[model samples]
Target: MSSVPQPPRWDVHRLPRARGRNFLVTGGNAGIGYFVAEQLAGTGATVVLGSRDRAKAEAAIGSIGSRVPGARVKHMPLDLADLDSLKASVDALGLDRLDAVVLNAGVALDRPPRRATGDGHELMFGTNHLGHFALTNHLAPLLTATPGSRIVTTGSFAAKSERLDLDDLQSTHDYRPKRAYARSKLAQMLFALELDRRLRAAGSTTLSVLVHPGGALDSLTPSRPPLHVRTTGERLSRLPLGLLVQGKDAAAWPAVQAVLDPSVHGGRMLSPRAFGLRGAPRIEPLWSHLADTTTAARLWTASRDLTGHDPTFTAPARSGGTEGPAAGPGEADASTG
Candidate 1:
């Protein structure tokens, strides 16, 4: 009998060349998102860091340049808390064909006195889930136009124990900082899976992949200077924890793999290999809660209504212009956030 062949093991240190390809990472100015942008930049891809802070974005760009000589990276202003601004932000990307987008930006509030977004939705849920939802819909044209494009949604390990109350997605009735943040991430994960299902149904080429950083600690992470710095003592102190939890850099592997790995299919989830914590990234089975299609579909509907943007997977007809499609209204100023 023939043995089943295993897929090639992914090496986080070595990545495939993606010259001329364009990719975006939301919140790439810091944390796991920053590492994701840096890794992609090493692949010779044009990496855009979606951030709301120009100063932080520039600093991150400089940090990547310092580490990876000749790195191609820039920042696009993005405010996930402002739903009305998402469409304009997508337009500012100025790329004719977008290869992939990493939905990784989020706001995790730990203190009391629950806050809301500009649109009046809970801060975590609105910015983390709904904002990405609207942004994806707005970028649908570019994604579908580019063959084999992907949307990689970064979820969280905290989401494992939390369940979403679809009726109160905004956490209006019951509000807890950690619980709200976890549910928001759960919603984002569910959206990624449901999106793949919808894409398949529509016969679209764009793929939606989900991923989560297991346990990322700044103390365990290597420094990138201006963006992030770890002292020798800090590293030594966190060395023991490295056995279980990893740094943000390692946490970025799964998302990067989802973007560049040809074998990675839509609707799949990737995570750390060692008990879903501090090892290299590997494919993981979707949690039982994430497999509930009924919940996902309902959440999708609610998202569409709240964002007022329906994602259509259809690709637009290719135009003759070499620079890609012309910018839509309010897209003329790429520098404006």
Candidate 2:
């Protein structure tokens, strides 16, 4: 084929402004992070950029403001690798209520031994999975108050690397950089679906969804992959897969669509259009097993325990897999990676 194709579309651009909406987007300093925040702020929403580096966040915010002059954009400190930082972040941004929260911050590590966070959990699992787990739990109260609130998170097509491992969430038993990364992402996907399920069961119709950029990044989490696999991922894009490598700019499309599209429902998984690689925005489903209510509940329970916070506070009991309200001041925050 001369060029790769994109995903199915359904006239999504007509969506109106996000006026009066307040959002918290992690890693909104640059890359897809900035794109997501920029799109939202451009549409007239108040966006709080959550990042580890205050300096970096400030720069990113400045750029966003410049792009969307007078855009309601602000910055807050959020270090997914450190639990203490997570708490400080909550205290800083835990407002009266929040309209949306997107978990987009992550690291791509080089082929290296597994690391741990300040809380002593595996770094990837700690930062990528646990960090958001606590943040979401803490902010549930705000979500419940807002009728159409959303929590959007980014996953990876590589999420299939391994199945959910309740037994080895920390990867203390076996650790391959790719496998561990996949596990963490899988954990994130499960959390997204499970939170959605819990909300529906509780008679709450708020939105919680998952998204991935496909094989969208030349660089991924800070932890590097094996040279061969990583190099292979980088190689195909420049050659045979050039058309499919829609670039990181397109990455924010799927996430932005998820955030903006009113038709999107809870439990949906979105990706870009470029074949097995990349494209525009389209709605897709996660692995069938990801929707399993049993696993969803277990994952939620385990996450609350791992993060040392109650995911659902007065959020009401959940049915399917989602439990807890969407917004509550977070407690017992933990790291992501």
Candidate 3:
């Protein structure tokens, strides 16, 4: 393990053992999120599925139970579009430590001029970047205290089209759904790298890694009861697009690799090799602009201002439990029920 173990391509069936660990996968009820949760659970990890709909979460949990006998899976209500829900969910998640958190929930937008969140930010940006920012900040303490923990953010190839306007992060002045999505993704990529830098500087054990599933389509994935409702459209659509993209299970491979690959380190990005659209997972180069430090700092400040949650690198002391420093800049004390 001195050098990053280059597996014979990214294969979930070959993932390292993950027993006695806990993971939280946002949007784990469907799509690649669900498969990521499933793959991790198959390896004996306790997985918490975070979804906006409780019914969807429960359905996902049930599906996991049936797919992998004795899978340790649970559901928690989480709505990334609403910061209040984010706060409440964190308070309710009473875990002292989490091995990894995969930020996978987001609005996959295809139309423009959509609705905004309660916070008044653009929907995609709010849900994709801002909400995750708050959640990670709040959970920083638990992650920092957990040895060799990681945060894997789900990124996208759409980010290549982003033209960042730091002043107009929400794209309030001119809004197009695709560009809005791209901008949010660019922001996420920057934040991931920046967060890694900060975590290392703070001497925390936690690491931040970003991974993307390139052009994955739902049509090719296996159906889960009530959740993966296989539609005629999916079957028909797969005829043409099936060869062009990988399925959800295949797409989840990179994230799974990032989670268990001992060779992977913080600030690295894992993505598909075939034009970033379909193939085995690999570490690929990204747009230089997306990793600009100055922009990352600006986005970090804006995120703090918008969400009011900050990562202080340490958690407050807990009696009869793990303890660390008190809340300081950008950090919060334990939730006061």
* Candidate that scores best on lDDT: 1
Per-residue alpha-carbon lDDT of candidate 1 for residues 1-337, written as tens digits (9 for 90 to 100): 9999875566777777776788999999999999999998887788999999999999999998887878989989999989888888888888878889999999999988989998999999999999999999988988988877899999999999988898899988889999999999999999999999999998887899999999999999999988888999999988999999999999998999898877889999999999999788888999999999999999999999998987879644556753422221112121100
List candidate 2 stretches off by more than 4 Å: 1-15, 218-240, 313-337
lDDT digits (tens) for residues 179-284 of candidate 3: 8888898888888988988988877767799998998877777777677766777878786776678888889988887876666889989998788888778898
TM-score of each model, in listed order: 0.92, 0.81, 0.87
Task: Look at candidate 1 and give me any clashing residue pairs.
Answer: none
**Order of all candidates by lDDT, from best down to worst?**
1, 3, 2
lDDT of each: 0.88, 0.72, 0.80
Writing each residue's lDDT as its tens digit, candidate 2 over 215-334 gives: 655443211212112355555546654555654555777777777666678889888765535776777756777767787788888877777886663343445764332422121221
Candidate 2 lowest-lDDT run of ten: 328-337
Candidate 1 wrong stretches, greater than 4 Å: 1-7, 315-337
Q: Give stretches of model 3 more than 4 Å off.
A: 1-10, 231-242, 314-337
Error of 3 at 33 (Å): 0.7
**What lDDT does model 2 reach?**
0.72
